[model samples]
Target chain A: MNAIQIRTMAKDFILKEFLPGERPENLTDSTELITDGILDSLATLKLVAYLEKSCGIEIAPDELVPENLNSITQIANFVQSKQAST
Target chain B: MTVAALHEYLEQSARRYPQRCAAVEASSGRQITYGELDALSDQVRDHLRRIGVRPADRVGICLPKSIASLAVLFGILKVGAAYVPVDSLAPPARNAFIFNDCGVRAIFVEASRAETLRCELARLAAEPCLLPLDWSDGPSPLATYLARVEADGLAVDESARPGPDNLAYVLYTSGSTGQPKGVMLTHRNGSSYVDWCSDILAPDENDRFSSHAPFHFDLSILDIFVPLKHGATVFLIGEELGKNPTRMASVIAERRLTVWYSTPSVLTLLVEHGRLDARDDHALRFILFAGEVFPVKHLRRLKAVVPRARYLNLYGPTETNVCTYYEIPQTIAEDRSAPFPIGRACSHVKARVIDANGRDVPRGQEGELAISGAPVMLGYWNMPERTSAAFHVDSSGRWYRTGDVVIEGDGGVYTFRGRRDRMVKRRGYRIELGEIETALYRHPAISEVAAIARSEESGVSIKVFYASRDGHALSLIELKRFCAHNLPAYMAPDWFSHQQLLPKTSTDKIDYQHLMRME
Candidate 1:
């Protein structure tokens, strides 16, 4: 999966994990994930598994951080940025 | 509270209720009678002694909720050693930190957890023998340890000889510091708390107790030991209880449980969504809640269900082992929070609300609480400086700071307001302010820092507000690195809010609450 695809999947997972209700398949850019309590604690843990399996990338334990895995946008940007640099 | 010693008490109960049921693992549908709990605890105790686990040595217990775990806990106490209970499900690194922090001599784990338990012990530079749970009465590794180690002989005086002065158990609690602090307790403190609880719950031979809290959490001290001391049976609810409250409610009613101990949040979940009918469980006699507040609305609904069962609100931190408690009057349960109150301090425990300067505050003025009594812990294990700071001597060296704000009310009743200190609790873990402050100050772009706990997202969160330096920009990575450098994983703030200048009160002290609300 590409960075965009992974972010969309993570957004979907967070929505289900928190709200536990049906959601739109295509998330818009203006998704208020944190403001609406969509993504919460254990975000980094959930995202770690998803990213390692989906993008074929490994997350260093020290890399787990709120800012780095706070939401779909930051996560996608982090993945893309890391891949680009590597 | 001149209760019989642990072994004597269990022996008496065993003789009295030989055929009556004592322990049950609902997940496995395995039940042990009072006679069985007494017998198994004795076996575990004797086995432990045959090994070299001398009396008063720290023994770590890492296992899931099961009959073996329950038996080992009581057995450890029965033989006179303090058993440190660690939740098997918690992060292995965190558990490893706790094991290292306490310098536990040995740990008993199930076969499944033995690998991880050994790994943690190895990281701590200690060689703790891993005793598996599948002993099947066939070469029980623990049984072998009990048999082989000469030092693991009988408890001092051939019984659990811990008077009020000995360390009962050292519970490792959370902080930003990588090391967790173990709060030491004594047999006397536990018995005092249990004495009050047994009297309040009035558990009889027929009463059945539902154990919900993990053995590690102090709440279980009452749920597991109280029943054993009272000769009542305990229905050991496992991790399955966390998955579905309805299933657990069924266990309570189906098993005819007579006593329940859990957090207010769990009871609300069961009542509101699990559709629990408290009245249906006629066998249940008491419901005790600690670790959080029980809202007034839910109290009424509970009364409507269990009209005969008593509902108690228990309050205290790990150090105090549950000090103040209120037995819910049925009228208050059916009415409003107004009729409810934080009850009087337990027997022999003295409570005083004091100010920041350590002066006793007048009634109705919110101030930090200082508690002095048998229940105050022996201070944090291995952190003498931090322990001394919190556990201090007044003019007479008689008081321990509670860090909680309370107000004196009519008839010696006290009401809780908020905390006077920065150590806040979220999801049942105590957080240290200094840890977060140290983390925030590390941001290269930050010149000064203050972290405070504020209400957020339906729970408590660390609101870290810092003053930014003029030339540098505070990158998110920089901030994360700063916290990751000096604090424990949990002490890191969930949210960071930057400010040009921190607000201050008239006395030049940081207005922490005001700064918290800046965002």
Candidate 2:
């Protein structure tokens, strides 16, 4: 999948799994997930697992910091870079 | 023959093992020797004395788990003052409540949190002096600040060491009334447990213990003080590594941590997500769990992975540090369905299973557990009425009501049933929410479970919220069927919801208030 498709799929998974009751339309691509408490440590792990399984990418231990998983946009970019490197 | 005060023990340890490492930062590998810890604490103590922190005054240690934070704690104790721990990672409102409630004269905060804490402190009625413990990203580090203090030739005042009766620290616990209550623990209360652990656990200078629980929680008492009392090393796990299973397992393997203490939920995380089974070659000797019930299945799984380590279940509330403890037998792995007992009382503690009328319940009967001993807290701070209500004095002795219902079995063993307040009436039947929670936990897919009673216009119904195991998705129908087979018809949860994570209090217990807010 392309970067935009990856971002869309990530957003869907986040809304469905992490933010259960939050409205999908209200969450923008740049919405803060880690800092804003939408995604906690446990949710961040779930998101990483989902991204690796669905997008067929690998997330390194050091890459799990907030900088890479703070937003859907950042996550999409990270996935794109990892896929390209492969 | 007598025991020294907490700070005095540190001084003695420093004298005996001056070059031995006292603490290490797990992530950064920062080490603090006993001599360095003692000297650094003296500097902070001098600073505290200069700022008018007097005897019995409550000082707040709001910094994260680091070498600097440990120094700040000992520094407060050196001044004959009790240190109140405010979890820097917790919400500001909660920290503000503790600062104002305890009437802390000073708060040692990290430089990164100084601005936010200063803003929050301004709103409080009591104005506490702010002491920067260390700089996370700021200009001056704590070591530099201490060196400057020494260079300025500031005279260290005479120590006013607190006695056993004097308060050591006031740990605030989550209250049901929307505010937290501070449990005042004296040096005697803490030393009782530390002394018992020193003799029983026999931690030597070579052992390395992991401080998994936060300083605010009582479980940390064993982690921080017991090792310090015996001149052993302690490894402080930061927030990130505490939750990361892979990182935690690797740290355990790399550091060769000998003793481990944490809640069962944390252990379950390491068991499921962490490659603990693969990283079996380590020095892990004792796996201690408390604060909540451990699922038998999960405990069995963990025991299988760490076959050489001894599994211990400690039971107590915040009022008393571990009153009863049970060492799990090697045979428990085979019979996972057997009920785990909290075991007999400790050396300095007396436990009684009494009913509503303050009479002892016969063996094989359920009653509320009450503990009375030196380990029991003096009382709640600043809340005399609540304190009197919590502790009852009878002809035998004074007892602190644990609020936990338990069955008294043979050999003075007590098996936890549920909390007395957790029982709710529904459709003319009294149902314990913990039972339903235990039933839901038996489901293979359910990793975490919490049940609450919601009374709506229709009627009172039990609502359940759970998180599925890693890489598993659970359906409501399947959960209901599992519950129906395990529990009675009325005991089944009326509603179920899937959550990524349950909100937790600063002590890492499930925040029922936040769960109630979800509805």
Top candidate (lDDT): 2
* Tens-digit per-residue lDDT, B286-348, candidate 1: 888877656677767777777787788888899987888888876763334453566788775
Full-model lDDT for every candidate: 0.69, 0.80
Candidate 1 local lDDT, residue A20: 35
DockQ of 2: 0.22
lDDT (tens digit, per residue) of candidate 2 on B1-519: 235467877888998999999999897888999998888888788888887999899999887788888888888998889999966866565577789899999988776777777777678766798877566434225576667556563436655667898999998875545466799999889888888877667789889999987787788888888888788999999767787887888888889999998877788878887878897687988999886667787888888888888888988887898999999998675656755888888888999989887898888999999999899999999999999888878999999998889998888888987777876545323456876786677788878888898755334577888888783446443554466455544455666788888779999999998999896
TM-scores for every predicted model? 0.74, 0.83
lDDT of 2 at A35: 58
Ten contiguous residues minimizing lDDT sum, candidate 2 chain A? A34-43
Error of 1 at B67 (Å): 1.1
Q: Give the TM-score of candidate 2.
A: 0.83
Which regions of candidate 1 deviate over 4 angstroms? Answer: A1-13, A16-86, B4-7, B134-160, B176-178, B277-282, B332-340, B392-397, B427-429, B433-452, B456-515
* Real interface contacts reproduced by model 2, as a fraction: 0.09
- Against the native complex, each candidate's DockQ, computed on alpha carbons, is 0.05, 0.22
